[model samples]
Target chain A: GDTSSAPASDAATSSVPPGHAGDHNSVKYYKGIVPAKDLKVWREEGTGNGKLAHYKPATKVDYYKIGTTPTPAQIAGWTIAVPPSGENLPAGSGTAAKGEAIYSTNCAMCHGGFGEGKNNYPQLVGGIGSLGTPSPEKTVGSYWPYATTVWDYINRAMPFYAPHTLKPDEVYSLTAYILNMNGITKSSWVADAKSVPLVKMPNRNSFNWKDPRPVTHNSACMKNCVSPSSIKITSNAATMNLTPRLTGPVDHMKNGK
Target chain B: GATMIAASARAASPAPTAPPADNSWSNSLGAPVDARPYGQPSKYESSVVRRYIPWLSPTRLADASFTPLQDQPGIITSNGLFFERYHSGVPTVDPKEFRLMVSGRVKKPLLLTLDQIMRYPSVSRIHFIECPANGATEWPAAQLNSLQLTHGMIGCAEWTGVLLKTILDEAGIHPDSRWVLPTGSDGAHMDRSLPMVKCLDDCILAWGQNGEALRPEQGYPLRLVVPGWQGNVNVKWLRQLQVGREPWITREETSEYSELLGDGKSLGFTWVMDAKSVITFPCPEKPLTQGPGFYEIRGLAWSGRGKVKYVDVSLDGGVNFQRAKLDNPILDKCMTRFTLPYWWDGKPALIQSRVTDDTGYVQPTIVQKHKFWGHDPVYENNSIQTWQILASGEVNNVQLS
Candidate 1:
């Protein structure tokens, strides 16, 4: 299966082989949760004919204009986000003491330290009258109503195992030390994007943007509909069984109880 | 319960006169055509897997599971127990060094590959995806008690590829574009923003699945369905789309899936995915100890803003309810499967189902989504679930108060 369409017009960096130069190939390549590299192998190099030569184009192309445009500095190195009127934001400006030393060596294990979130990670700071309470604790300064979602989520997902490797002022000093531990600004405040959406979050007037859905317009009731003595009970996730087990087609990462 | 099997109307009454006298695989001679060359699924359906709740990912590059959806039935979703949710793990791409590209506000920026995106013109469809934190640990109450951990992230399949406005109509698009983003070469470069009229509507760019070739944890040769959005914008290993005009949001639309309300604003690209329903045989991993008598309750209803028109059920939780039937083709944002049949009488009831999709939305209770997503709905969490049963018959996963 080595069809050679012959168009070899010289140098492609020579010294080929190594299984067509794809590094070490152990079927690696998956980019998602990233870690596997190695598979390489797409060698076209210096015509030393070690096979793989199917370059027979020019028989009149344009299969929807074939491909190869990518430029603007390769789309500005993947244009990372940070909008919310601070447009693209990526410039710099940090404070709250450089986000407490970039939140202790890249976000303490997983969002801890001043952000107060570490098991199941997500605390970002006090719950400010816990949103209509029932155990609410949203954080990011009492539930993020936007501070450009804290410098676009710490420069697109902060060092949670290295995502976008934070920089724009270390994502504006961890969004000014997580909005100064959620007191919503201070600790000498100073993030960017127009004072990070002008702070003032505190449940930002309890969001609404539509979708209220038929929360309880109750209809389709083929019978009684809400009177069996007003059906009381209210909670119980299966007497604490905690589900988890599901294993059979092959243990999907065990651990249960 | 899940893995309950046999119920095409209860196998159309097939118990007439079964032979019970010395049946040895019905008297021997079986194993033939490539005996076990590659087919298996009947060793008692072996519990149907897809679990992995390792405290829902904190590392190893995020990944989460759960989708045995009560062992599954009618509405497809068996690409090895579907429901995945990876944020970094699962990449091995290599479709001859895949590519995709597309580029922002395009007037002409193509970069296709994966055999020019399987040579464009394809279509299939069936939809579903979900996981706007499918029940984000039931935001504030009755948490995970199976319906594959309360509404297994969700799956549904079929999906075939190419229709992102047929690759943005050969990359022409540029009338002040209006969001597109997509991204996703994995490694948390997940990306989001969608809106170019949902990639010119009906999204897709898929690469098969349910008809095969997509597995690599469901984004093999490429991925990006977006049908009904939020399954983290369906950007599996799909690589790039860009087409801007603003709206990158990212960080999974601003710190994961975004929804939070109860004031403190969050919503962001809400997308569709509203109307929802679920019964999944007697919850808590299929309980009810075989139901005091006749059965058939079944469940599963969906809606990313389409089909599912009706589905009620409620064995008394919402007071009485009834109209359940629904099954067959229902299509649209897929997954329909409903039933009813009744006759338990063993007492202590309280089930629930409630849907209402064709845009009318419905499907809400859990104290009206705890009074409008108070305690900020970590993610979608469709609501109305309930369960109960018990008079020794078992069941549980309750809430309705």
Candidate 2:
């Protein structure tokens, strides 16, 4: 009898949330369950109170996961990253003889034909024990922790301006060549991710993790801090009450005092 | 014999001419044994170095490198001399093989080659590229000498590039696209997301720096030039641009650039650099001469949001301020040179400059800045720089309070 009664039909149709199971209203009941009309909106909104709604496709989805799994060859095309442990070793080998040729053409201009660095270009060989010294310059034999890192870096970025220009085989050969020059591997040895990681660096045990704790700082023993026996005051001027100045001798200062 | 004697007398007699200063070449001249196709800085300029105070960060190269702001006079820093800071080492990229792929949330996923990018309508702008951490030292000590803290990391160059809006349009961005992520082709593969608005506003894909091709270290073939933003966001050795509906919380955005606040909540993805200025001359390294008349106090002022509206110089530190004249061609989101003609009587003087941006954001004092941001210093320390000039014409870095 009232105007509200006339709009009840319209309210029933408009109650369902957009892009939800309730929008497809052909079925009388879903999986032996009938949801109340009022609960349609709640179910559609995913805010239903203990009531299960019909399954609906998600509005947003990751399309990358929807595709079929790529083949090893296809995956390898994009994933050129070689890990420190040599996990993704390709089915190829490269000898130092082949590597020498690649090095001369690609790397020798900047790194020198013999791996001696020129200017800003880094040296690739020697300095096996220079890690802990006052001047620590990193090279293949000296500072690199893993040989696989060299392979990875070369494969990803190298030759200064032209990065990722080398093939996987070429990268392997270059790695072999550099390692052979550094005396880590023999000239005949082929370098892959596996063989590269196994190559031991001379300074592999040189580095120690620095921890700053328990107060590394110390003050003079005569002051508020403990002085070790290593600290010796050689000057007797202080005990004699004669301050030894830089310009004048202690005798003149003592006589003046 | 009489004529020779007359000539000798003329030579021995001091001519009424100004004697030439020693014309001997400086020992710093001549190329090293190995000649470089590209010239490097003079060996004597070794004092002008990129330094990292270890206390800043233990291992991060993104820590800081002061630009030899004192050693340079003109606005431009040679491509090689431009300060570099990287989360990872500089990735050597080959230009010939480089390819830029644009995908995600687009009608046409385009893989544009470097040559294709060069074919686009190009525009050149003289903009200053500055790292967000350019003046990081000012955060700890605001009254520190200006050049070392401020000038070193900022370099002006004529960047030639295509508008990013053109590239986005060419890629056919979908209606759902809200953010664009530019990724570097480096070992770390550093990535950062930009709001669609900023990308469409004034982003550039630069290929040329200064007058020539971009240097290898400065992203030779191509780089994203996000003007007025942090330098890192202007991804070097750029390889990919992915348009998406949401921001990618990459390593650079999450682990590194995010500033940890006093409340422990980090201010994440702070892209825009605030208004900042620094006094270049009469800094710590370059002391003023003993006597002074009309000394031209010069420095740089820039803003990420917009043009530098005004720069104010204060001789008594931050007490009294005078309007410094801005050099011409003050383009939007670019460095503007500000100069103050002042009379330095060689007495002790504390000099500082405050820049006001078009957005009405004034460069705050270090104390004021600390109050708002707290002591959580990572980068983007854009505060007023101060220098103390001693009576003996020695300039030293000093704290205000």
Candidate 3:
């Protein structure tokens, strides 16, 4: 039923096969997609193999004719991302000593005073050697490979509720404060565009770049796949009663009610 | 009555042409067509809607909702009932002042307005977008009882837009460009670094979904669609695309998304979601109403790698299995609906489904997943799902050791 991969030689298969929904034609719903009468004409175009009937591949055209060249002023306003190499890292400097006050006033409610995490929010510090243990605590100090990401994240989406409100100096101070709390840096260490990108974290080399996927090769074993004696019921969600009940479609006067 | 019948049957037999006693709908005039300028679903289908848990996130703005997969009949999810995931809620952008900027590592930096973007050659394709953390809650055990809660983070729809290749070609990419950083216009300014090959392959700057303008939650005026990748990388409320030489280790990619291995070293950039499937009909929410009779067991199977080649349904745990029939329009990287004819025998049974993608990769079991990646990695939980069917015809979520 893959129209794009269908052989061109199978031109005889021009009509919609039985048991096939009309929407399967890729046009979907002749009511508004295509007029009811034009449906027959669409199928006659030899595109009835399930590909989008209206699609046409791109062709040659004049370049730089439609959109205008973006001015430097406009580009400066929108460019906000800081890459790994810290190429576009912003200017300004701050120290953990200066950021201690900022952390309590802005970030400590959800992120915690010692950066150990509060409630359900993510913990920003510690968990350096917990990755190999059974209970891995993946935090900024333990997991993240680069420290510039700390500054970037703080600058872009910190304070949770009021993001993009922190100034560049405040972001640098917060990054330094988090680093100091994680024991990666001292409270007196200054952080800036030049200094933040150069700071080496413990987990700098703790990443696998190559992706060797299709890790599990499972066969469709049909009969006696596992010993019946080895089968065990690990958990049952019905007994927990954690699922929320709401009245809506498919109520059936049961648990959904 | 017999005398009246005899009087009516003058030439032959009398005709029974009277209307049914209770034709309530047709007994009165119907509502006018313009009653609802923009129509909504019938009130009877109120329960077939998207839902979210209150405790899923810290705030309501940064939350996720699950689509009622059990109620969705086919591969395509209706626009209104589609799953919703937001980082900073939805922002209403004025189309008159919107512009998509293309800069960094490009020969010509261009700023295209909505009208200019719509003028390009457009192609509409059907694809499935799935959150990598779909089954994260159930990793430790079966915590969610409903299919909507377990597998509701995914939705498939027909998307219409111009290919990123078209836009890149217009701007003329630099020879040294290898990675692209796409940033959003939301409060968090969600950004992700992607390889150039994926961008040039099937990425689309989409503005339309399922035949009309995209909903505000799904990114109204414009969004980015990286086919067959994690939903996070498909930046919504797209604002800019910056071509660069190296990957930008952003917060979303580093502090999150990456998989932490058992050995302490994590696997970064694990984007493609492997083959996964779930039995939607006989799940916790949708139980077998009729007792011990012929029924159709239906489910959904898909892969980020490619089309689903086969889906096998097991009615008795993992002891035995039967090949399920794959429905039509199994397009590449799209959701495939599968069904199996089943007859319940009034006995306790364990129902499950397994999928094999076009790349000959079978859906792994939870045990097998833990063997390689360990149980700590929270993302990418695409393992075989088991549902216990009781003798009373109730289905419950369960885990097998």
Candidate 4:
């Protein structure tokens, strides 16, 4: 029944293939065919074979190997990303007093004066034990795992209307202000790249990189496993029907009648 | 002036007096602010706003916005009025720093800048960009009220860009390559893998919308415009393109946009949107008020696969149908307007429109569509929309029993 592959005739082979290529004949075919060259003679010579056959010994293949390396200043301008572990922290300092001024002028309208947040704009502080509860409202103090994430997020996109408008010192000050409000930093202390990364967040140990438990079953259910009864039953009839009976309410029954 | 007199004299003679009146917008305004560097929609047409149904999607900041389908008259929808859908929100990317990298199965890996993309031979096309879940209504319960529900999240714009086939050809795609993965530069870094055949067929790296540079929301520097396909595939803020033998199965394809069937199986890549049409005027919000004279019933019809061939309007619901006249220049994968003149008797009537595409696919009924897709994620829900006008001139969305 499956006899689709039949040998093409000489006429068909000389013409063109099917589908998109065949529609445009000029695109489908080559003018002439060349015979394969014998490789035995080439292999006998020391000039051909091994890596030397494809490439020369003195030739440089890579761009960096040809002495066309990028300058350090160029790399520093683009690759300024600092990690959460304080691995590539730069020398800078900012005080909580300066941070409060920056937050009030730039962020107060959307994020509230005290970073309490209005409407659905997100609360920046509080909600200390809300995680893993009925309705979790994750804030800087309660849910964020790393202080560096706070710094990175503020530096990258913040102030709502105009993102990346703040200076480096302003971003540092704002980070200190938000951290101080969350009770993570002292009111009088200033925050730097060195100090900010070491200040352990309250929920730093709350999260895990990977979940061990399976979110859903992987294998296909066949044979006995495919039965309706084989499906996981979470509750029974007795538990489903158990309700508090209204025995003492005669007035309610008379109204229904 | 001489042509106007000759046309009027010929019309008076009544020798098969020109093909019926076009009844389009008269005294059409020319392109104002022509000398300005950028262009925008007319000042008089500023009331159109992208709406949101509060009950369906609760959050204001996080939820989707609907295009004002009822308010828009012409075939084109300006770039600003286009609907927006975001996951982790729109990322503010600096155009100067933006770079598009093409890697993976290619002879030459290219890192092209925005300036280089603009230098390529660009082609402009007037096409419709629609979200797969455009008409997501709670059918069988209560039909939605406005045209915003019937046909929102869809817009037509003149997109100017380089054909994606040109870029792939330049890169010299390997023989083993089958899929092209496009990654976004948003905070979520959203990505999707599409068949290489679709890319080669017709895809664009658009930079201009409505004859001007793209808006920030519509991907200012560059965005993939996959015409007639779902909106998500037109990845905004495009950053990377990776050629691979197999699909990447990103979060968008696997978790979010995939549709779940009745049997608990999922349809992963339902790309092409079927034929769909919607009656814009005399809908629930507009109502029928002009008494008994000749009034024009106009609306838009389009297909994802090809150009719309015919649109039939039924006054008495689906009982009787009449062919509506289609406007000129019915472009492929673009919105086409259809109109019919009708005289009302100041009585109750149920109105509906059906679209037929060049691919010979007809718009299915609500019941028929429900039977096939079984609606969980509500993507590609294209069905015949009905508007019922009461004797008292009260209009509402209704379904025939």
Candidate 5:
């Protein structure tokens, strides 16, 4: 690094080596420089009574005190999320036998008649114990850890076209039917708030929640990283013929695909 | 005969200073302001538009349209050209009728209209939102030929909104609450359980994009902008926030977003995007048209953890690396532009760009990524991409062993 020794009293536009007078490398740029170690970050306690420390607000006045309190009816209408505990599930029950008719009409079009999946739509059942295989099929039976997810999803987004139209009983019935198709429950078993939570999914304890990241710490190996002869071209996308035609700048351009 | 000879003489040796005849636009008057209340790009720029493969999704309603990364320049993606990933069709949300309900494990549950949300002290920050499955199709092989198709599942923009912490503070979050389930009001009513720590951090309830009201396709009324996190958790058409003790284990978190492994186990809650960079210019669509001359290679690099510290350009397929100049205004968790001056020799070269974030994590190679995570886990494919430039200045997507 070149040291800047230009006189402070000189003209501001001094033509010096390594840096111009106005740029960062100039001597004047370091006139009021502060040491990096002295700078410290401090956060104020968040407005919420929670213990987490948050960034200090720019102003002292409370800006979020504008909204009005929601009424009991409003709260009940919007609070629809159901956790794995099933404590928030609505009062409803359905049998897998009764859910069979609902599945064929509503879900069978996309999720397949037996939850095997159709087209690009998600498969809901089967593929149990197939995660270790070469090609694992991650259906609801083999992947979902909780049965409440099935109920919540169906109640919230289902029928492929008409979502949030299913009654609580219909959602429960669909959940039961999907579970029965996966061989997790009997057709006669009743699926209520109580029995649904207790129904153990085959892959309930399958997930590793803690994110183990930075899995590959590849360094910048710049020199002769790999042998030229050993480097093989494993695949080429141009030969695949999967690229879609578009009206973009490359509409007329061809890469000899 | 004299006139014909003069015409032939002019055609054979035209004066270099003479202008061409096709200057119609220069001679004519441009359109007036009244012509378009809302401005649009030039007619010639119609080629620069978002596109999608029809077969990618089951239906058009629940699909994704990729951004034209090749055509885009700089960091900020235009509001109209930003990538769109909708679970169902875009719902027509009336701002006057929109109400965001904050309930579940809160002391005073509040119902806030769009106007009330805008009243809070607003802060705008630019950040990139990317789908977890950005390069999922190219894991085993480079399935998409164009850069837009391969790496267009991301868009960076300046989002304006109130801090979610401020709203949650007013609601008075319960001490036991660990998760906040954000539910969209779209046809799907898409819901996802976001960890409470993330909500309190940089998450904002964004209502504006690129200095304008949010587009209907981008959740006109309100949308949660979880910076650096996966796009799926940033629920658009945000209508409700339910603070809870446990994660709701929604469909997205389970069978959809979770990464399945070959050992009969899956990794859940993998939110943050790793360091990644890709060269936009000299890509498949924008190849080396100006053959064998001084060319400035341009690209975009970003990370979820922090700012990109530096980017390295490799002209010889990772054989050698040289630091590319990173453009200024490098903010945290935002796209950073990088450029490298090069003289192409018109030879076959494997061009690649590698990014190292502030955390000192170098972007992994495709082989390195597959070695640890295998060919599955169809998300978080931030591996270094290779564009094979042939002798004829044509580029192709290829995977190297």
Candidate 6:
């Protein structure tokens, strides 16, 4: 099944899988993934060792005719994800001044008028160098590594109440306005694909990742793992008492009523 | 104990005029099988349902509800009770109208219907899907003081669907196709580009959860099941899988999810969720009562990379630990329930559970995890949670240094 690793060669050996040859003329593996008509043809006319001795060859491979090739137009419509590179940037541009109006009309309610963020909503401006501090202010300008992410997010999921409602140019304007709020961009700057990716957000390189991690590790210690006397309570939560414990009358008490 | 003096007759039953009356159909025939048609959890379980942190998001329309892990009985999370995190709202899609499009750098780009998808030979495997953000608030010791609040962002279910490779094979994956972008049909169009290696490995295009059709919140009709990956990568209501060469580095993977360290350097392709575990019992919700005599400290342990190797329980912080008995049938990538029965004599106690997966990566202490990822970005904080149980039988979520 791991056909990717082994390149098919012209000098076929007994060990080579039925369809793993590198060339197009090789016994390519369908693995039962063909269309209904194609599968029918394969069952009848295919000359490969599919029709084996005594065994139903079709039973070995599992394939389904579940999906179809989407039209180019459909992919264009659905694949709206904008990466950090700002590739596939739409044809539109807007200035920070234009973005200010769009931001107030659409995003101001939840994100705050000036992108200060209200309540738990994310603040879009300020906190330029706060990421390294004990208390970080992660905003569009301060912590976002890529400026295109802001534009992509607004185009996709912003306006909290109405997602994907903003037009491309509106999203650009809003991106510009938010970047300007963070001082990542000038008020006169226009945000298009080329300019948005260059906003150079602060704390852009603050995220750390290592896969297959125990980037920090702990072995299974059966006893005396650490000095019990050395254990210290760094934080106390009893005084805060933020957890909501809603208590009500019990309706069921195992009585036969 | 004070002796009970006989109270007034009215105090007994408010001037009991009628003693027997009737049974009031208490013994009547139970309601017919179709009396209520579909089934639901009993009304008494009203409080056992999911709860969301109201401060996390503005409305339930685009927010996550923590699984009631503390209240849950076993490893199989109920379909209705499964934890759901939705960036956009849950979309109402007709299976007949749904078409999964597979295109880009493939020989046979295909758009398959849901019926056609079911035609493929299906495989059922139980895997735990965890949001890396599990126990995020406790990373900096915020006040979300419950197991449901701390560790409820994960749930395991027996997911049934066709292997992602089965479909990719049908599409004739080109050698150039290094990454596959599976996009959600929700309004947000949430999409995550999974590396081709992971797609070909063990991912599934799942439509069934816990032996039934997926609940709407759980991405009904279809969703991608990237076992051991972040919950966001499992795009629900999957609409398309475009095979390509480069990772899209979408918003879900970039602007969010990626961990921001104290040093201001972020990691982008941190795909596989690390090993983690938590003690569900004696949590803030299940405070130790009655002197905690012979309490079986039970909890769930799991890792994205593989099976949970062993879980250890520490009675006095992390100073010492004892091997906890893991319940039978610890499947790979599924939650393993671990229990350690210990006798207690009503003393102040600090309890913690540590996990190690089959990969031999031991679950780190809170201090150890923070050492790697300092502060601010609060995703994947799967550190050992220490619960301080006071002599008064009240439990508090505490961090030990």
- By TM-score, the best candidate is 5
lDDT of 5 by residue, B1-401 (tens): 99999898779766434586446676789889899999999988988888876657777798888899998889999998998898889899989999999888777777889988998878999999999989888988988888988899999999999988878777776555556889999988888877677787889999999889988878887999999998888899989998765566688888888888767778877889999999998898888987898899999999999999989999988888889999988988899999999899988889899999999999999999987787877998999999999888889999999
The worst-scoring run of ten residues by lDDT in candidate 4 chain B lies at: B53-62
Sorted on TM-score, highest at the top, how do the candidates line up?
A: 5, 3, 6, 2, 4, 1
Chain B TM-scores, listed for every candidate in order, come to: 0.37, 0.88, 0.95, 0.87, 0.95, 0.92
- Candidate 1 per-residue lDDT, tens place, B1-401, comes to 54345555355555434654446776788889888887877878777777755666665458677787877977998888897888667878898888878776677776767886787578998888888788777767886666786688888999898888777767766544556777777666677766565566578888889877889987798888877767877888877787655453444654466676665455555666777899898766677686478878898898987899889887878877877889788988888999898788899887899988877767877676766656546777787888888877777787766
Off-target runs (Cα >4 Å) in candidate 3 are A1-64, A246-257, B1-21
Tens digits of per-residue lDDT, candidate 4, A1-257, equal 11111122311433432211100112112111100121121112112223222322121223111112233343333222333333333456787799999888888777888889865566788876654453445576665545655665676456655554567788789888888888777777666755565566665443322112111121111123223333232222112221111112111122221
C-alpha root-mean-square deviation, each candidate: 22.6, 19.0, 14.8, 19.3, 16.2, 11.8
The candidate with the higher DockQ, 1 or 4, is: 1
Interface CA RMSD, all predictions: 21.5, 19.6, 10.4, 19.8, 10.0, 9.5
Show what share of the native A-B interface contacts model 4 retains. 0.00
CAPRI grade, predicted model 4 = incorrect
For model 4 the local lDDT of residue A249 reads 19
Off by over 4 Å in 1: A1-62, A66-74, A81-257, B1-124, B137-223, B226-230, B235-250, B253-277, B280-298, B301-340, B344-346, B350-386, B389-401
Rank order by lDDT, top first?
5, 3, 6, 1, 4, 2
Query: What is every candidate's C-alpha DockQ against the true complex, given to 2 decimals?
Result: 0.16, 0.02, 0.24, 0.02, 0.25, 0.24
For candidate 6, the TM-score is 0.82
TM-score, cand. 3 vs. native: 0.86
Question: Candidate 1 - CAPRI tier?
Answer: incorrect
lDDT for model 1, on a 0 to 1 scale? 0.67
- lDDT: worst 10-residue window of model 3 chain A: A17-26
For residues A54-159, write the lDDT of model 2, one tens digit per residue: 2122222322222123333433354443333344446566878999998998889878889988644668887655444434445665555446557766765575
Question: Which segments of model 4 are wrong by more than 4 Å?
Answer: A1-257, B1-46, B58-61
10 residues in a row with least lDDT, candidate 2 chain B = B53-62
Per-chain TM-score, chain A, candidate 6: 0.67
Runs of candidate 2 with Cα error greater than 4 angstroms are: A1-257, B1-64, B142-146, B149-151
- Which tens-of-lDDT digit does each residue in B1-401 have in candidate 2? 99998888777864534563333364347657678976667766656655433334433333455556676666677675677766456667777888777666555555667877887778998777788767565554432333554447777688999888777776666544656778777755656767676677678999999878887667768888988888888888887777654443343554346554443333545677777888887776677775877788888888887899988888875656788999887888777888999898877887878888887777776655666455544567776666777897777655454
